[model samples]
Target: MEYEMFIKKSSLQQKMLISFLCLIVIPLGVFGYISLSISKQTIEEQTITSNLKTLGLISEKLDIMASDLTAISNIYFSNEDLRKILMQPSVEKTYEERAKKEFLTKMIINFKYAYTWLEYYTSILGLNGFELHTFYDGRVEIDELKKEDWYQEAFRQNGSIIWVSDPSPKLARTVSEEHFVSAVRVLKDFESGAPLGLLMINVNESFLFQQYAEAMKDYDQLMLLDANGTIISTTQKSLLHQNIKDTKYYNQAKNGDRGSFKDEIDGKRMLVTYHNVKNTGWSIIAYTPFDKLFANIYRAELLIIIVFVIVLFLSILVSYFIANRLSVPIKRLYRSMQKVEMGDLSERTDVLGTDEIGELGRKFNRMVSRIEQLHDRVVAEQEMKRRSELQALQSQINTHFLYNTLASIRYMLLTQTAEKVDSVIVALVKLLKRTLTDENEYISVGEEIDNLRNYVYIQKARQDGKLEVEFQIDDRITHAQTLKLLLQPIVENAIFHGIEPKEGTGCISVKGWEEQESLMFEITDNGVGITKLETGGAADITEAILSRGSGMGLRNVNHRIVLHFGEEYGLKVFSQEGEGTKVILKLPKFVKTEELISL
Candidate 1:
């Protein structure tokens, strides 16, 4: 019934088509776009960052070159021969001319070595320009001493160790044909604190500009500037010496900040990054043409548009076929439900293909099976309820025996046999307690022993010691769990039927022990025992063994034992016509402390 309702409520065709579009087509489209966009941006950013790092390394190499020049100049200024020669008159310079030449030659050799080192370093670093200048007295010298603007500036600064000059023309015999941004420093006399000479080191402007041009290869324009915001070098040399105060990058660099920004340069939109060198106060600028930078993105967008149009058309065609494939199962299920609703219980959906629609078909089948099982269960429960009512009626009839026992106890009390009356009353009370309490059906062997003891005490008092009851209980079996009142009824039967009816002295014994994993309790007696006719015709005996009572003691105990401990653990009877009967109760050892509280 439920299966039919589910099939009626759901449209297999619509759900299958919708889920296919959502789970497959839409996700593929979205994922492709997202992956492409993220990957492109990541690649671009990584490229720009790599270029920035290369530029920084180039700047570091230039700073190192300037430091190297200063170190060489310091060595020259501290040379005792040079200092002595400088302090002497020009005529004395003639007398020590040989020593002076040797000393000067050595100094020149040292300078040559330093220049060679810088040359190799610069070459490897992809840089150029390795010029060294020296100031003597009031003049500067490259290969020969001559006064120059930068040299004069350094001599005037005296104590200043380093200075970066604006872009300047290259001196012929010194740094080849390329112009350079130069660093100048004044060498000081160590003892007299006088200016010895000024040293200048020029870094190749062409090479530096080339790096900037490479960095912005995909851009239209790129420029570099000095501290004064003057364009020192550019890809186009014509832009050199131009003051770019109005430029966004220049204004930012002038303020001693470094960052990238977007702006219009000569009517072209550009993304630019400016960085300032601290020691030189020079700014390295990189500009990327915005249109070129996003060229790939534009191309991708165009491709996506084209592909989307094609996919849209393809989807229209595919959706129709998909809809057809999905609708077949749905239409079949719908018709099946319609048949089921009209009192057809055997209707089933026949769906093929391994997809969501197929899964729905399998689920519908399972639902039908469960509904049939539930109907069967309902009928079985109704039958069980009827049987239970009948059993309750049988239990009501069994209560009369209990009432008769209570009447016997009343008679004994009235007769004033005080001891006998007390014993019977106690026994009757215990029996009633066991019968009425339904808290828990299972109990421990120790509890069963205690119950049997009470029964024995009452029976001994009634027999007046004519019969002696013995118990052989293994201590280990005391903790084993068994049905409550399991052993008491069996003991009662032994005493009343097996022992009490005998003419002479009789003995009844109750023994409990564990064998392997099982607990066994036996009730045995030495008496006239049961007659062949009585044993064979004993319907009550068979009932007791089967856990079905005839309103007798052993039968009820067997019933409760089987109910709690299972059929195998209920009761077993072994008897001989002239000897005693032994009834054995078998149960598994399941001792739970919780059973104590219920008792």
Candidate 2:
């Protein structure tokens, strides 16, 4: 539950990364594990089978050797002289002396004839002092021979050969017999049914071990055991003639002809493959250390695990990269949206692509731009309503200008004729009546031009005809609605700052036209133009005259124009120090208040 809760709270990148790893890494890990396991099992089974085959080959070779031994023992049966010699009565001691010499001579001749064969020391111990021996120049007590283990065991086998290792203390073989494994059998009379003597064939244990020398390893052992689990011939000479250890493998091998088992022998864990030699009724046991047999499989398993880890690590990085691609754009867009929600209309996402996230970011940016446009228009409309009520009282900043105009009329009344004084009075009354009216903010281009004409006329009367005004408005837009009193202040500034300051008569031109979807107006005056001044005074006159996009009057006008329409409709100013000043004011072409309110 806690893990699920943690996952639920994770970021998108984390969640995607986790999911990818689970999908790929878990299954891959399990597959790797299973692959290693199957490889290990297969290798183990193959090795076991291979080792068993090795034991089979060894057992086959040993069986051939055993069969040859048994066959050689049977060869002695065809020797009529040896049989007749053993058949001599126990009471007749006359031929014993001559028989030993003749049998020894026959043994030497036989050994020379089969010199390449597994060399053997032959011997016979008989009843009634009929023994003929060629094994070693040694003697044994004939009275105590009945108690000898070799004699007793051979006698119990009737006529069959009994395999024994290092088996002569009573018969007393030569020094080499200590390392010899021999086959002993009792020879009996076929016609009389009476036992004659025991015939023994001794061969060096090296003969048995040499049969499998190529298959023997330093850590492995090969042994030939009788049906009773006695070690007859073994590579390890010390184990010859000893009873096989009581191991589970030996117990299992004794019950079957050929088989294998895992067990510990002589304190070392090993795999034992055993087979029985049919000719001699002996078992061939091969011991191989368990670890040495399968070391390669272990190394391969380790290497595969390492490769799996490297592959898994690479997959993790790819998973993270995939998650990053999906999550980063969303995060950027979300942050931008948060800023927009907090009223930052300038917010924009830098997320880039042609995917869905990129489209969403672009749509969000467009939506914010539109919202800012609507916010500005709404603010402008509300502010315009406030300004309508507040601006009705003639602005205090214009009081000095009004008083000056009144003084100019007084002067006109005193110095000029009644006709000139009446004209000034009429112009003053006309300007004041229009400026103070509580009407709608918009008026026709003709009415604005007429208003500017009245203000210019009053100024011209005061300036003694030094100022001249010109209008070059397009007739196509003469009846177009525009803001009231917008041009009056511009023309008044031209008279006071441009025309009055000039030594000769000066001209102010007011021109209006329609361009594209906007209204363009240019006001030009032939007077001393604007300059960047530290203390020269008249920067406010420049602001009022040229609409330089700064200061109170023109900046406010530009702000209002931009707010009402968009960023594309604003004011532009160009001025030279001595040539002239021109101001271009752009507004939405003949936009009605109804359209603006609906927008």
Candidate 3:
């Protein structure tokens, strides 16, 4: 009934449809949405990273150019002849003055030949008012130039080189029309540390950036901005020397060393990438339109959307057909199951195809056939076993013992108190019912010990409470199995042969425990023990053995234990003349539930 209710709650077709929606269709839809959403952002990030690499390459080239110009200035500062000329005393007609001019002119000519990139270079002396250059011949007084900001800036540099994009008045006089960038340093005497002069190396700005500007024209504007947000050089000539201090890009670029972001530039959505030049506080920036970057991504997203719609439509149709195909076979199998449950085992499922469903159908038919055959065989066998068990039960219980128990109960009713009579009768009736019934062939050690206890109660009554019995059974072994009435006989022998015949007070103790997968019961008594035999053995042992009858004796109990469990398990006896006797019983510990026998 419970199984039928579960089948009605969710049929096979509904279950299969739900599985497709959750495991296949829904996952595919979710994956398509996630990929499309992240693809445009990922492309923009990759473009920014590529632009940073290009900026890094440009920065490296500019650094090398600056380093080479500084190295050339260092060469002239170390010249001994140039140092001597700058350190000479100012005299109108000195003998060393004429020769110094000739040497200085040759040094300037040599510099021009060695470095063709240098448009011109000038050296001005601070001590003597004299200036020498590649194109100029005169004394340009340092006192006049020292007042200018560019000159003061160089002087303040303290002999270190400084690159300045703004030219000084003296420089404008030499190349007034051409835009130039200059590296200037205040020269000093190597030995005396006195001020020798100022040296300047100037390069053409347009010539230096011509190639980079041409290459960057295919993209948006590329510019190098200075520390004050001024565009020092750019592909757009109009932007040169323009300060962008008020612009959003300037604020953003100045805050970080290098990064990229999206913002509107003059009503156009632009992706801007910027990086700071090392040691110069200048930034290289590129502005490109966002629409151009995401064009390909938009096209791909459209294609994915169309494909997703087609797949979703086809999935509904396919799931319906697949679920129907499987459910038809499963429905037939369920019907056959219901027939088998109602005892109509001849029902079989018709095989539809050679797929998994067909294979399951074949297995189901075979199982039903096997169950039907086993059912008939089981019924017949159970009837035969029942008769055998009845015959065995009849043989197991002795009628003579029952008659003696009834007669003893009658005498108890006449001579004993009513309370005593009722207790004895109840214990006797319980013992007879347990031994006569064939419900359980094997019983727990504790139950058998309980039945033996009832027998002890009857014996104690006969002896007028002279017999005292002690029971010591381990709790772990009590749940284990033993044959019914196994311990009672050994306990009876302890009382009759060992304790009852003694003159003084006698005590019998029954102990039960487990060892090495075997149950052990020991019955010990302090009574007149067995005497020694005449023929080199225990005395009157055969008579003592004969005293116990066929059903209730140590030998009979031992034989039954050996027959049920093996010959290795039985009884062992130890006795002396007057001290005590101990009988040990051993049997294999069988659990009733795990070792159930049909008989």
Note each model's CA RMSD in angstroms.
Answer: 19.6, 16.9, 15.5
Using all chains and alpha carbons, the TM-scores for the candidates as numbered come to 0.40, 0.55, 0.42
Model 3 segments more than 4 A misplaced: 1-33, 88-106, 112-127, 135-144, 173-177, 214-218, 245-248, 255-257, 298-599
Please identify model 1 stretches exceeding 4 Å from their true place.
Answer: 1-40, 84-106, 120-156, 164-174, 206-224, 231-235, 254-258, 316-599
Model 3 Cα lDDT, one tens digit per residue, 1-599 = 99668657987798788777677678887898888778877887788888877777777766666676777788777888777777766665566776777787787777667766544455555456656665666556677776777778877878987766645555655543345667788888777787778887766657547525644843577887766777768778777777898998878977777888878988889988888876556778888787777778888878988887888778878988989887888888888889898879788888646998889899998998999889889878866764564345435445655566677778878898999978888887777777665466678888988888988887776666689999999999988887777777677767777788888668999998889878888888998876643425553243355354542466766666666667688777777678877888888877765563421
Q: Residue 199 CA error for candidate 3 (Å)?
A: 1.2
Q: Which ten contiguous residues of candidate 3 have the minimum total lDDT? A: 533-542
How many clashes does each candidate structure show, in the order listed?
0, 0, 3
Instruction: Return whichever of 2 and 3 wins on lDDT.
Output: 3
The best candidate in terms of lDDT? 3
Model 1: ten consecutive residues of lowest lDDT: 120-129
Q: Local error of candidate 1 at 528, Å?
A: 99
**Candidate 3 TM-score, true structure as reference:** 0.42
- Which has the better TM-score: candidate 1, or candidate 3? 3
Model 2 off-target regions past 4 Å? 19-31, 87-96, 108-112, 130-132, 168-172, 175-177, 263-269, 337-347, 364-599
